[model samples]
Target chain A: MRSHPHHHPAPDLLLAYAAGSLNEGASLLVATHLALCPHCRAEVTRLEEIGGALLEGTEQVAVGDDLLAGVLARLDEPARPLIRMPDVTPRPPPAGMPLLPQPLRSYIGGDLDRVRWRLTIPGLHEAAVPCRGGSVKMMRIRAGMGMPRHTHNGDELTLVLAGGFSDADGHYLRGDFAATDPSIDHRPVADADGDCICIAFTDAPLRLTGRFLRWLNPILRT
Target chain B: MADTTEVDRLNGLLLCVARQRDRQAFVALFNHFAPRLKSFLLRGGMDAGAAEETIQDVMVTVWRRAGDFDPSLAAASTWIFAIARNRRIDRLRRDRRPAFDPDDPALVPDPVDGAMEMMLVEERAALLHRAIRELPAEQAELLRMAYFEDKAHSAIAQERHLPLGTVKSRLRLALARLRKAMSGDTLGEQA
Candidate 1:
């Protein structure tokens, strides 16, 4: 029973997460939030259990050949490292970045100051992290900073890593996920208390309506 | 309750692998899970070669990571399913496939907490199996597509030529009913 984000991801989104179908960026946020929310984690576990039960009773259309010989041969060959499942015990976040959650620390190496951020515009900076599926960027907005109004061409998933940001909807705090589709448009402004840092990913490019800021689009990774 | 013997047998196999690294235990685990894991991978849209290779890799992984298995936490099938899902994700990453995105809202290392006390392991498992068995045929087919086929609800709707909204609502209802059956509540609420 952990205190969770006021707004959680949709049920369908959670279902996709359980099925291992959600995109990576959204997965990152979901995983992070799941760490913060025990209830959702429990539900996901149940869904996974059901998935397992389904698999168990399913028709066992056995593989045509014996794979054990190949596996045993590999076992006999040598003890090589696995593809890259990181060690279970992850290192602690660097100083001044305690708010950065688990799995993110594993990926980005550490927290805010540890990451090398590039300035996309005054008071707004972003850094692109290497990932497989979508363009994942860590965005930073200084206190009271605002962004030009824009709409997405595809899905845009932004999870707040630190501080808070308020858009046309409401203020989003750390661990809150903001999922925007192509039909929605809004301007987001950082809270006055401190800088707002978020991990954002987009399947396709964002469609910026304001022309002056449009030229900077190339810098706006998502 | 019907397959209590099978349940204990699977648990015993995992225990043997964890305790002794017994190759015989490994054999049984592989024989039981590999085929089904392949089925899951195929549903997730892998060709035969990829599915076969992935399941082999998964078995080898199970043999190696068997120590991590705690039968007290989840059923053997549940643990194997997680392993298969992890392997599938890994394959997706290595092959640079379109579907292998690890960044979904799912929590990782979602180690099924032993805290829930959700009945006995076999009982809880039977509860889930029974619920899935009881779903309306159409809903059961949809569940098959969503979990086994690895198809997104939107994709399922498009493939079945149904409205996306209808697909979503039906899936939601199915999930809600399943949850009620398993945990005595429609788990995970809005705040």
Candidate 2:
């Protein structure tokens, strides 16, 4: 496992994970961290069980007469099929690029057709994936291409899948997850010769600050 | 009063509401959590109107994201509180870069002073409360101070006239004990 000296998950996040407050994408990142950190995962499991017990014990209030009817009507609504996106395959891994991490295989996939490419920045390409809850996405950054300097408008969690990246904080490689608070502002540069893939989730859109890309903020949906 | 078993059963009902888009369940959840969420925001310094608006947004998010709720992980109130906290922090960060205009009446409104009614619909809250009450008095006191007063460890230590490390050690021990008690484990050892 790749290690960063300061890569501990925050208490709030552990609490949120236990509480199930995180979105699907963010939850996956936390889950990955929990898998690596047994102590934290144990705490999460304990908290969740406590929450489940608490929920189980809650009292029910009288429902408005029409509420059930409205719910039944919506239940009958047809399921929406997964929306497929146009595909963009990364160049075949150079003769000896390391295999993608096991956790990421289901997401990145063996066939290019299964993956959906959403938007392409100079070094990054993001795509949304169908999951149990809602859509989750992966952003792939080509080697040497760094993301433009930007700060988050809300909590942003990223889990590295392939290659590596380093910011002012430290190096992050496969299986390493980083959660950045809104106060943190830095640019992440991909390793010189290896592409980096990460799964990230954010509530507010990213505010990019590069001189030429400032105008594109409205268009970049993170 | 809600029974613990009844609350657990409601999870299945909630799951149905969430998966099947049951409006009643959504409404029930909103009625239960919205006001409390509003009060939580008010504590964070938002005006009543903003707090109400934020609650509405959080409830709507709950409606849209209910399927994401994994009963295996948390109780509904805890989950709802987390969302409220996230939304409030998001708003605070958004307003951070802008200058605060002290003269603007809209921005300077006094904080709301009412407490949210603790009509917990979940019977488990009572059990949890009881478990907390059953803890060693010192541990219980520490937990209460942490949650109710929302004070930092240093403050808690200073107020209690305890060493800083002693305070942290006590808090950790207390939480561990609470976890065991809530989990139905007999206290076999003390940290």
Candidate 3:
């Protein structure tokens, strides 16, 4: 019964997650957001079932020779049983830690202060996390600060962790999921409150479109 | 394609494996699921020997973890594929930074609960079959490439010579329609 973000991830992104086709970086963002949003988790589960249902209708292919024999040989000897999805990941990040979501805690090893933030611009900082498939960074923006107007070289998925931000489309609050592809043009500005913290994943670096800032695009390494 | 009786029988087989270390029941489960799992892995362009290896690994894991099965939470097919999918992910893992683990503990998918409400395979399969049948041919074909072939949207777009946005939106619409049907929030509900 926890409160959810007003802005949910696009159904297409969720579908990709359910299909297990999304890359690791984007998948990390989606998983982190999902830990906070029950509705999205339900949708993902529903999509998984739908995927399973689709599997039921597929024409079965014959297995290679020795498939059954090989499986039967291993009947007495089994490898370590799989650890189910829920068993390994710790849930409920204590009581007071509002800033750290479930997926981030393990990545940062539970120490929020240890995050190495690089000052990318005045009042804006970017901390890159090690992830596969793409660049995933945790971005912090001061209240009332606005990023340069921009589009993207690839898709970008940003999951707001704390405070708020807004773009031409709409406002995004904690746990909100916002995804934009290369085709989208937006200038995001922080809300007039405390600073905003969000994790953003992009397959390709962001391209700043503003006249002066466009020159900074290559150095931004977004 | 799964009839009610077939689903019932498969359900019973899994239940037996759970209650007892029933090798015969295990064989039944293996026979039914292994070929499909192999085909699935192979179609994703995995080599035949590797696909066989993965399928064997999946079956072994299924037997090892059968005791955790709960009929109320998931159908036998759902549970089986959940494990298969996870195993597949394990094989596909690249790099070490841990991008995301769907197997993470707290992110358990919504398991359909309540014995009365559970139909396991039969009802869901039938509804899903009809739903797929009803999807626009493009969407249906895309769904097949995605769900079964395990192709990424980018690859699908490349293969079909379509824009990535079109692939995503079409999939979104197709899934929305199926979701409505699966939840029983159908067009009939308005009547």
Clashes of each: 6, 11, 2
What's model 1's lDDT at B107?
30
TM-score ranking, best first: 3, 1, 2
Per-residue lDDT for A11 in model 1?
81
Q: Between candidates 1 and 2, which one is better according to DockQ?
A: 1
Residue A76 displacement (Å), model 1: 4.6
Expressed as tens digits, the lDDT of each residue in B12-102 for candidate 2 is: 5567667887777776766665545544455456777676666655666666667877665455655665555456544643311111122
What shift in Å separates residue A62 of candidate 2 from its native position after superposition? 12
**Span of ten consecutive residues with least summed lDDT in model 1 chain B:** B95-104
lDDT per residue as tens, model 1, B49-123: 899898878887788878988877788898888778767776764521122113333233334554566576776
- Residue B72 CA error for candidate 3 (Å)? 1.7
Expressed between 0 and 1, the share of native interface contacts present in candidate 2 is 0.04
Lowest summed lDDT over 10 consecutive residues: which window, candidate 3 chain B? Answer: B94-103
The alpha-carbon deviation from the true structure for residue A66 of candidate 1, after best TM-score superposition, in angstroms, is 2.9
* TM-score of every candidate: 0.84, 0.45, 0.87
DockQ agreement of candidate 2 with the native complex = 0.05
